[model samples]
Target: MQETPFCLRVGHLLPYSMSDSNTTDFTNPSNFILIGIPGLEIAHVWISIAFCTMYAIAILGNFTILFIVKIEPSLHEPMYYFLCMLAVSDLALSTSTLPKTLSIFWFNSREIDFSACLTQMYFIHCFSAMESGIFVAMALDRYVAICDPLRHSTILTNHVVAKISLAVVLRGCVLVLPTAFLARQWPYCRTNIIPHTYCEHIAVVKLACNDTRVSSYYGLFVVFFVTGLDMLFIAVSYTQILRAIFSLPTKDTRLKTFGTCGSHLCVILAFYIPGLFSFLMQLFGHNVALHFHVLMANIYLLVPPMLNPIIYGVRTRQIRDRLLRLFPHKRI
Candidate 1:
């Protein structure tokens, strides 16, 4: 006998009426059931506790970054401007899904309206793309500051930074807008049960009855074209930065030059490594457990937002000093 489709196996979970013979289709499904993680439902409460903690940290850390950057005159430079953009993007990205995810885990409120799912999908992807673009901008700032110090200020002027910020935001919005439209057009006849915590692009597409090669391929293209291109640019920027740092006359000069890039490199790695791993696993790791895949997806979304401010606070002298000054009496 053929295996039961994943959606039908979880059909009882949906509050919607099912077809009499289990052969009818739910063309649009109107709404979807998001089962937080398959094969680990028993552990969801425990998982929610950890996820809730991370969500709180992400909120507080990113807000603190924004607050400090806004109030501190010393952090008004191009680098910190990019940092502010990063904090904003992180805030939006995490906020896009965490509340709903927590609701599913905490209250068993797993049903999401179709339109709401699409909106969540759009924001999640748009901010993700925006964050990648911001990383590219931050990389360029570091490159100019270290590799071409004299021209850094003139090149990355206030006007230029503003323009770059606008471009990043527009690029993300335009690129991800298409995916949502494409997803909306799909006929989700395969039942409305999404096996993951959130409405990920491929996961939603997988629920469609018709051919979704175009949707899948387009999503992959966006990732490879926009995100891949951004990574390429960041890699080149760091290459030049390293070469410039090594060429400095004194050891102390080299160390100082390299120090400026340390936090950025760490943040980039923290964001991209898990991102790429999850992407590849979704593509090729058919043998991998479904819960593992979903868990990795959640981790990729949560970890960077939680860690970025901490990494910057510990790695940057100015931010660290300012943070200490803010909490002078307490040991933070």
Candidate 2:
């Protein structure tokens, strides 16, 4: 008989494998139970409708941006490239979490395989980190356009954008990989029911009884430190941009400058504020209602993806004009 590979054996043992009769041992919890928003059980039906709508809008909006960018030759610039990157990141982010989220609300299906939860947690953090990186790239694009218009084309060439995209992807994957490894090391010894709709790094880490501070801190680092670095760069870029905008000769020029950044700023704020709130909830939210944690995490994941396309589609003159031309008879 052929021997099972060591990796395969470990894989089988990884879930529901650890149990001590003296202590609460969930060991390898083969699956995790997701109890959707506590106390709102009866309202899940109504909530499903809303979440489904949000998911639909996010898909439609991001795909529309993709379609529009594909057809419009004039939009093949670094800025639009970054915008496309953002759209792709949003799609990944939303797709990672929302389908499972909606399933719990609609199908009454709540059990997620242990490995599946880990995969979900990894992707959720990975794409979210990519979003942060893309924002920084976008900010840099805006900075170059405003602060050094003459070299903007040369500075953010297609090759450069490709490199940036590659870097963003690598960074996200590399930083978030540790989280899953850390989770794998900690033995779970309690009820495997995760008290939320989706599996996040923090959500899963909180379940382990061991000294989980490392996993929690690493999560915080990914959530706060990585994003903070990106946000810091974005802030610096925008500060330079604002100074350049203010130095312009005319009020019209200043408004135009601000107009160029408005959509991106909106996207930034939409992504970060709820993320910060959710991060806080993970820390201090013990005092607050459990539902608030559920709500904030959903907002952090769901709201930005839903809003980014709408924000850009309306605020961007190029997208607006092309949209108008494409559907001249219909009101956008």
Candidate 3:
């Protein structure tokens, strides 16, 4: 029998090998192959078109929000300040994965360096946590504006907003730091083929050769502790806001109070509902098709960033007027 070629043996031991338990000892692959959507390879080119459009919209819309807030002296208040933070978070979260995902779809460039994957994973989760915190701050801003109108400015002063922004950044970075560290410590002896477009935490951990219970449980803890706790605060704030609104003597007062939160409420639902669904499906939906889960994961990140600016621009009178003003010749 002819001897096996050296290249074939190395290929079998590393990148091209498909066996899950192929490595007997602790080993780490130099890189991973992201297959994009597992069952949708035939349509990757078409999907890339849609992904490109959404990314373009997200980038343009967020930059516009940041610019408008920066230039408009009247918008230099706590509410718009929190809005700027939210816009920045959305930009960062989407950007963390969009480039690699587009590369996979457009050019079949599926290989991602191990360290790069970890960095992408860290930023994606960190910014997601930060975005949740920003939403809570925005909710509090609305609560004070409606419930304690007298002290709205005094309470959420520029000084206080600065503190809140710092807390949001620190909380996300510190909490998510451990997840990346845990992921890095794992020995990825399984097949290096990740069936998703990006290096999601759960997906990456599931490939490790050793017990991953600690990492998995810690990730769940961070999700609930950060996202769950922030959501609870938002709920309490909104409840107070509603109660304060209804106590107002006139119907017009109630309508006006609720109107102030319409954009914020829309944004909250857009960000949280799909996010929760994707998380739950990953944990419990064992029978759910893999492609469906991956698609939802991608959508959970993509849709919110694209929709947030549109929702705020359409529902917020201030942003709408400023956006309109930017184009004098195309006045409508």
Top candidate (lDDT):
1
**lDDT per residue (tens digit) for residues 45-66 in model 3:** 9988988899999999999999
- List the pairs of residues colliding in candidate 2: 15-28, 16-28, 16-29, 17-28, 18-27, 18-28, 26-189
Candidate 1: where is the Cα deviation over 4 Å?
1-4, 7-23, 330-332
TM-scores for all predictions: 0.93, 0.91, 0.92
Steric clash pairs (candidate 1): none
Model 3, runs deviating above 4 Å: 1-26, 329-332
Report the C-alpha lDDT of model 1 over 50-141, residue by residue, as the tens digit.
99999899899989889988889989999999999999999999999999999998899989999999999999999999999999999999
- Per-model C-alpha RMSD: 3.7, 7.5, 5.0
Cα lDDT, model 2, residue 137 = 91
Model 2 agreement with the true structure over 231-263: per-residue lDDT tens digits: 899999999999999999999989988999999
lDDT score, residue 179, model 3?
Answer: 97
Ranking by TM-score: 1, 3, 2
Report the alpha-carbon TM-score of model 2 versus the true structure: 0.91
lDDT, residue 91, candidate 1: 90
Q: Give the Cα error of residue 42 in candidate 1, in Å.
A: 0.3
Which whole-number lDDT from 0 to 100 does residue 262 have in model 3?
A: 93
User: What lDDT does candidate 3 reach at residue 176?
Assistant: 98
Best by TM-score: 1
Give the lDDT of residue 98 in candidate 1: 92
